[model samples]
Target: MTVQKTEWPDSLWRSTAEPLRDFPELQEDIETDLLIIGAGYTGLSTALHAADAIEQIVILDQAQPGWGCSGRNGGQVHGQWKPDLAALQRLYPGSQFDAFIKTLGDAVELVFDLVDQHQIDCQAQRAGSIIAGKGGKAVRYLTEWSKFWAETGADVRLLDKHASTDLIGTSHYDRSMFDRRGGSVQPLAYCQGLARACHERGVTIHGDSRAVRISQNGNSWRVFTAHGSVKCERLVLATNGYTDELWPGLAQTIVPVASMLTATAPLPDAVVSTLLPQRQPVAEYAGVPAYYRVDETNRLVFGWRGTVSGEIGSLNTAHLRSRAVRLFPQIA
Candidate 1:
């Protein structure tokens, strides 16, 4: 039997994202104060923020800008990380838990502020978000989680089963935590819009210029691309999930896991009214987590964890849709 190569899934973001000016390939050696590798959210945001102080900032991407994980994410503007207060308390005790929690709340504000300041047209919605608790055990945990935030003056609240069912259009969940600052956006469009903003601020971004190698050259570091190179005082490797052996033991630190999502054709208004009516993004908290949102054009996009190399639209991998249908039978 011959080994057949599977084609990669086409991205929904690329189809909906605003047109971005194509960046030219880097062709010659260049010198800059800071060299940022990977022109996704991290790299672009770095260059944008450093523009006011740093005179020479350069960004290089292996592919087109924002063509990585930043463009492929669910676009939920969430504020918390995986670690809860209990976990942080266990890890840091009295040292950094408060600061960490503060940062978590501050992050959502920072993201929305950036979007407002730049006037990015990425179909952004600030209608809020919800984390639904699946099963009775998860619902108990959800109540505890909500209380943890509520006691700290967070605007979060615990929604009862009735409230959650009405809001999420599903009876599968009995509890949920509602966050006012939560929302969703066009992920690729937002990244593309940010690229434009960064470019306008004099950040030089080069596409199709993958960093082949990096090394210390005199007092500065040299980041080498296939056709070009950059000499800079500081080098930032922001190659997210695509990170490789460029820095020894760096990639191993992050446990890489793959996520897959499927989008339905634009649902009718009558149908959308029954699901995500207020446009709040909903994430299910259980083993093998899943999340979904009402994206632009009223398309209900759903996602879940899966194999790294599985093909999209495959029957074996289409469990997400089946699960989604089970949650909201009205979706049919």
Candidate 2:
């Protein structure tokens, strides 16, 4: 479907986000030195970083910047990915693995650095993030993970059972790992702020400019949209999960997975003050689905594995709400 007919999922991020900064639709054919597809965090960050270095840059999105996962993420920015370090090492050389490990820390730093450097009003809080582990395996992995990072000079530590439960306000997890370098942001707001920053830095960003086709045109590449087209010397495609038939086999490179999030009504100050006392985001590794956080407004949000069927909330809200109450009897 075209952007005009796209249906955006109803989300707390959307409900709470400030008005989105506007970007014009591509109305006329243009040429640029660089063209970026997808205005999500990657594309926006890429454009922002290259604005001064590259003379001309254009960015296009199907709907709007932050309209996808970048805006709807759990907003828990932690320094870990593909948690199996051994598997990663098995796949990459030692040097490559080391570089990758360093990249994780660099990633967290980059997020906050961008926020600070641009003064992005995205409700950023650098309080830190916690991963609460449940069973023995989860606990051990988290413990070792924390130790590994701590050994690398990161401000990370593992909390014992009592500390984990006390900090989480629940006696469910056996332990928790805390990394001071991690934090959360108003994800949608952050995406919007990034888009605005890129625009102000002389990058051309267009919403509703879905790329329908990409073809070579002489020495450059041409992108055709419903309303306009862009010719650029180089093209960067950052359309991850929502990748489509823009270029041959590009969509197959990524799998489309979905996660669902729910937010409670903002709790009273008394309740929020007691919960997440340090304001760190908390995620649980004990159950089927687990990441939770306190947004800038002190609303409790929980996420779980979601279905592409688009009925997770309709099907599971009751259970999720019950779990929420279970997590914090303060709500009940």
Candidate 3:
């Protein structure tokens, strides 16, 4: 199905985001120094970064900017490598591993730095992030992880049960890790702001212009869309989970997984003051983990694994509400 027919999901991010000017559809053949497919964070950020150096840059998206995962994610700015640090050290040489780890550590700053430099209006917060561990394995990992980060002179620490309860307003977790570098944002707004920043920098962006095909044109690359085409010296495919078969086997390399998020009605000021007072986003690790945070409007946005069948609210996320209530009886 074409992106024109897909509707925006009913999400809190959508309802809360300020209006963004829409980019026009591609209507004519064009040539550029760089052509990027997908206007999500990757493509937008790439364009913004290259705007000063590269003279001509063009970006195309299937739908409006941030219509994909960039808009609908949990918004938690987790500032660490997903893989185990020890495992990653074993996989790469010392120099490469050091560079990778440094990048991972500075990832959060890269995001906030962009937001600050561009004056993005996204509801960005840099309070911190908490990873609460319930069982023995999770606790041990947090303990070691905290020590590693602290040894690097990072503002990170492991909290006991009492301290965890005091910080998170919940007593369910056995121990928790707090990293001052992590935070959250209005993800959709951030994406749109990035798009606006790139556009203002003379980067051409076309929404509803899905890259249907691509081929080599001599030393350059040519991209075909429904109503237009682009010839560029270089092409970038930044479609993450929504990757299609534009490049034959490219889509097969990615395994698609779904996540669902639900938000509570805005709580009273009294209740909000007691919950996540420092505004740190929180995650709990048991078996199936859950991540949650307080939004700008004082609503609790809770997220977890979603069904593979592509279901939305109702039965698919009823258990999510129950679990959220279980964590904070005040919400009930």
Highest TM-score against the true fold, candidate: 3
- Per-candidate clashes, comma-separated: 0, 0, 0
Q: Rate the local accuracy (lDDT) of all candidates.
A: 0.82, 0.83, 0.86
Give the CA lDDT, 0 to 100, for residue 213 in model 3: 87
Identify the runs in model 1 with alpha carbons over 4 angstroms from their true place: 1-9, 307-317
* Cα deviation of 332, candidate 3, in Å: 1.1
Instruction: Show where candidate 2 strays beyond 4 Å.
Output: 1-10, 307-315
Give the Å error, residue 91, model 2.
Answer: 2.8
lDDT of 1: 0.82
Worst 10 residues of 1 by lDDT: 1-10
Clashing pairs in 1: none
Order of models, best lDDT first? 3, 2, 1
Give the 10-residue window scoring lowest on summed lDDT in candidate 3: 306-315
Off by over 4 Å in 3: 1-6, 306-315
